[model samples]
Target: MIPSNILNIFTNTEPSDISYKEECLTCQIMGSATCLVAGAYFMSNLPFLGSNTSVKRNPIWWKNSVKGAGAIIFALGILRGGEGWLWNQEKYLTNESK
Candidate 1:
């Protein structure tokens, strides 16, 4: 029989009991930073139909900018909101083995 310790590695892990509050807090801060930088870039660079008369408008620019900004907002929101609910919960975990 395989050693129990080795078998444990293959088995579905029990829900993580450690809250990892510190790590979550760190991620939230980083996510906020990501949002700020991304937001600034998108706002300044992604505008369509600017004042230049020769500039041709591209629809893809707006779509991609909105999509990227929305994704960042969503990820950061999860990180920030998760700190209070996800990590603190007794049953919640990111277990992929199950």
Candidate 2:
């Protein structure tokens, strides 16, 4: 689980009248989605693009970049999942009370 401080870096919440500093959740979701999709696409097509040849070594930077991007995307997805779970719980509790 991401620490509250780190999560705060990714999302701001309004408590009473106080607005906390945080990254836009929507932007996080979009960024993660884009990175994951793009990384997957590039990785899948790399072999077919003659990048598999021993003489023409695939760039190490490219591999690392894709992996790193994918990891960020995966982390964001986990955070979003937590958010969604809390959202659903709130909705459920609200409905139950009514």
Candidate 3:
């Protein structure tokens, strides 16, 4: 079984000090953009950091692993950014309408 401390890192049982709604729009955009850019970079497999001789010798499995990571990051970016932007727009629109 996983230890409480280790599981805590994986699970967000406690509330965050700063709620998502309180986060600034700029921060949210930057966070999402960073994730998306990083994901794309990884997916591209441009040998950004692995241009070394030893890295070049890596097998196909390693490349596949990187791509998988990229896909996850890209999805995370979409979810995080989409939720924030959509929610804010909804809130603003509701307030304006009333």
Question: Weakest 10 consecutive residues, lDDT, candidate 1?
Answer: 89-98
- Candidate 3, residues 22-89, lDDT tens digits: the string is 54568878989999998898898684455545655766788789888998999888877986356557
**Number of the top-ranking candidate, with TM-score as the measure:** 3
Which residue runs does candidate 3 get wrong by more than 4 Å?
Answer: 1-21, 48-56, 85-98
Instruction: Compose the digit string of candidate 2's lDDT tens values, residues 1-98.
Output: 75457677568675554343344557657765765565566545553476656534757777666666666666555555455345546754554555
| Per-prediction TM-score to the true structure, in the order listed | 0.35, 0.36, 0.57
Q: Given candidate 1, what's the lDDT at residue 96?
A: 21
Each prediction's whole-model lDDT (CA)? 0.58, 0.58, 0.75
Q: For model 1, how does the per-residue alpha-carbon lDDT over 35-81 read when each residue is reduced to its tens digit?
A: 75666555454454363454345565655767677667666655565
In terms of lDDT, the poorest run of 10 residues in model 3 is 16-25
